[model samples]
Target chain A: MAATTLRSVTTYDLKLAAPLALGFLVFFVTPLVILLALSFQADPQGSRYGLTQYVHFLADRFSLGVLGSTLWLGVKVTALTLLLGYPVAWLHQRAPGWGKGVIMLLVLLPLLTSVVVRTFAWVVILGRQGIINAALGGLGLIDAPLKLLYTDSGVVMALAQVQMPLMVLPLITALSRIDPNLADASSVLGAGHWRTFRKVTLPLSLPGIIAGCLLTYAAAITAFITQSLIGGGQMLFMPMYIYQQASTLQNWPFAAAISIIFLAAVLVVVSVFTVLGRLSRGYTNA
Target chain B: MLLTRRNLMQTALTLGAMHAFPGLTWAQARPLVFATFTGSWEEAHKAVLVPAFRKATGNADMVLDPMLSVDQIAKVTAAKNNPPIDVMLHDPGPALQAVAQGLVEPYPVEKSAYYKDLIPAAQEPTGPAPFFQVVGLTYNPETVKTPPTSWADLWKPEFKGRVGITNLNSTLGTGFMVELAKMHGGSESNIDPAFKAIEALRPSLAAVAANPGQLATLFQQGQIDISPGNFNAIQILKARGVPVEFVAPKEGAIAFKTTIHIVKNSPNKELAFKLIEAALSPEVQATLMEEPYLIVPTNTKVAMKGEIAKALAKDHAEIASKFVFQDWAKINEQRAAWIERFNREIRV
Candidate 1:
């Protein structure tokens, strides 16, 4: 009787999960399979299929530069967001009722706005005759307007702002779950505030930091519109390169090859973060 | 109470008649899907061409599916066997690719009444060129005391860090590259001179705009005093009270043709043809040329007079003498390599 009941429960659970499994198979798994297959195909109008696309991407110096720059941009944006977001998340956790609500709203406001609008706003703020330049000029701090738009710094700044909310929300969730007594115990045990934060609070927040970094880094690398608007196509990131190859040039096979490689790079980075998070958790428990 | 045998028979007859004559229902069932430019371009078509097409064909079921040219091409390519779009509009470069890929069929020129009236250059082997956009030097009159007479004027010492240029992804950018090549004793096959000239002028570039809208905004904000762009965009900016001017450089302007194509194996092939014919008609051409879009008409029958004519390339003589055309097929083949090189070397 016990065996039959267990079998029935397993079958029922499978039946309940069937829709989601089918959806994943049809939507996600199938397209990825197609993309992987397309990566090996020859360029348009070429005869037969081979590894020509991948070979070309590997051989080209421009492709390698774009990939390296993309990874660098991802890292810079992720680091900037963490530096700015951690404090805001911590403050939100310690604030009083209404104050906490207001801070939370402020943190979420940017995410609620359209990315294109935010990017354009950054363009206005960062242009040669933009507000910063105007202000500096008015005060006689500088004679010449600064060249801010269409530069690597411009792209990084815009990306960090866009990806900050992603980092803050995750950190807030993790930080709120920590017990206040742990910090009190550390303080009573002769540790300074900074030391307590660095040893106790920081280690406990590792999972959230890892999650936030992974999300922000992946989003920064794959971002197209913000880079296109601010970088002005001069800063050719991998996503822009992929778009140019696919849409403007109509070279789908090469684009597919680049996309597959990008996917692999993202997966490797995410796996490393996950392992680091696990190690940090083990150390904290010990 | 009315369910007598005679009443029931009368109701049955009415239902049979409704099925027999499905004129209204049939027309409503299949709307002709046209994929074309978005924003003001789509608005212009809806205002003029859609009504004209409906009047000519007596078919009121036509839908305008606005999309970017690249997105339109992708959609048609994906659904080649049963294309979602009945008609497609694109620039000459992508239109040639579409023809080569067998995604579109040639326009039936013999069937179009306005075919004879179209300028010789407007008719293509694969599609009909309905309009032309002239790309040249656009400048702010307030800042640029002397109007630029040639493309080389942008590299003057006084204009350092004041000039803007579009990115290589756009047609205007490609045209500017070809113009530079011609000015420096090179052709499409030999673009080294062009690259050298652009690199020399790199220090003068204030920004490289990603799209026409961004380019216009830069001009409006006075961030750039000079740049290479289309006449239509300059005209629109001028109308909005921006003191900008478009000049035909001594080296000549590049004329890019906009092509209208009928997607292959479309369900509404006949309606699509009629729509293309209507777009080429003199009335619709004049409307497109007048305001908002400011497209130069390809139909010779439409006589653009006054300020609008002065702003555009007028007549065959002006077009032949002052406008340069590129082999789109060859340009398309080399575009990716040139853009990659530009991004790595010049734009850096």
Candidate 2:
């Protein structure tokens, strides 16, 4: 009799969950499913419904080049941010009293401001008559101004500035979590401070590095407005291409196809990172 | 150097290749939807057309949809099998693209009535489709002290960083250039010098806007003291007592007569056609002109000798003498290639 009551309760729970699952299918699952279906479609006026649209986007030489550059920048941004962000994170970790407050403010400033506002600031700094050139010219430092605004270097610089907050926060968390005794143990055993840090602290902090790199790379690849305003006609990224296809051209299938391609690319990157981390023997409980 | 006044149509001319979704037929009673854009078009749609359309139809429920040009295109194309919009106020190129691709059906406008009321250049002597009304350079007189009397005045170094112009691919920008070319030893016949001169004036161009409104806002702010503009913003400025004017400079900004067409597979084809008829009617067109004189209707009976029209055509006599409208259909075919090359080579 008690077992029967338990079975009835289990059935009641699933009955309630059925509607929620259906709702999920209706709202979230439907659009994604439709997009997947349409990604394959191609018609004369637009995509009708086939693998043709995806094939068309993939087949283009221009799109392939854009894909290559986009993927490269994603990796570059991730690596560069880790290099810059790790030091700031360490400073924040080792900071004392008043130093901690200042470091916290510095880290959070970029997060508090709007992305568009921050990007516009970069524009003024990077433009032809902007601050850097003015200072250089005023000092009689150079004859000609540097072409800094629209180049690939400009893209990376702005991207790094925007993504520093993401990289630093995770790393700081990881570094602070390290046990003080592990360092003392190495020193007690007559290991020098540098050796102890190299053998212990550095290896321990890498998981945070991986996590920060993952977040930064994902954010950088998806950045649209910053690249759009600065790049203009000069540089073309994946998001911009998707915007043009979806908005300017009104090719839904093409946009969907490109988005699917981008999603696949990201998954592969994430999978590779996971594999590499596993190979490094990250079998730690903490 | 195909010296046309606009970009080549990037929209592919692939017609009737797929069957579209016919959601709700016009035979059924559903309110017709008109896709309106932001700024002048939005104001006109809201204040003028919607009310008139509702009163005329007596439904009091005419639907107005707001989307950017590209978004609207996406919506229309996304719902290609089943279209939501019946009527559109789209640019000529997209309209032409739609017509060629069979997204829109031929709107049986009386060729004689449309052509007779319009400047000759707007007639589609060659292309499969002709859509979009032509708009040109309108400016504010209070701000433009020794105002631009011709296209040539815009190139002066005095207005450097004080002048606003649209991107080259836009109809008005293309029109402005064609006018300059005609005056500076290029013509509908020869356009090389015009390209050369435009390249020279790139240094003087303060900003390149996507449309005239951005240009107008900059002009109003004193960031830009002069602009090569369209008819709508000048009228809005004059309404607000901003001392704006529209010049016909000897090379008149190219004028193309516009049209409204039905999408072939639209579920709302019947209501769409009726709504279009109302949009193009004497009442609605006149209403649009009342606040911000956006369009001088193709209807000859509108009798546009009003205070607004006179104020808008600031230097009418001078512009009338020199105005030369380009043949748009012929130019539309070659515009994309020329614009691409100009952007690539001459934007130094």
Best model number under TM-score: 1
Clashes per candidate, residues 3 or more apart or on different chains: 0, 15
- List model 1 lDDT by residue over B187-237, tens digit each: 877778999998999899888787667798788767789999888778878
Query: Cα lDDT of model 1 overall?
Result: 0.86
Query: Candidate 1: lDDT of A172?
Result: 97
The DockQ-derived docking category for candidate 2 is incorrect
Residue B90 of candidate 2: its Cα lDDT?
57
Candidate 1: where is the Cα deviation over 4 Å? A1-12, B1-29, B314-316
Question: Which model scores highest in DockQ?
Answer: 1
TM-score of each: 0.93, 0.66
Candidate 2 local Cα displacement, residue A216, angstroms: 2.9
lDDT, candidates in the order shown? 0.86, 0.65
- A173-246 in candidate 2: lDDT tens per residue? 88889897888899999999889878887778777877788889889988987775555443677887677566
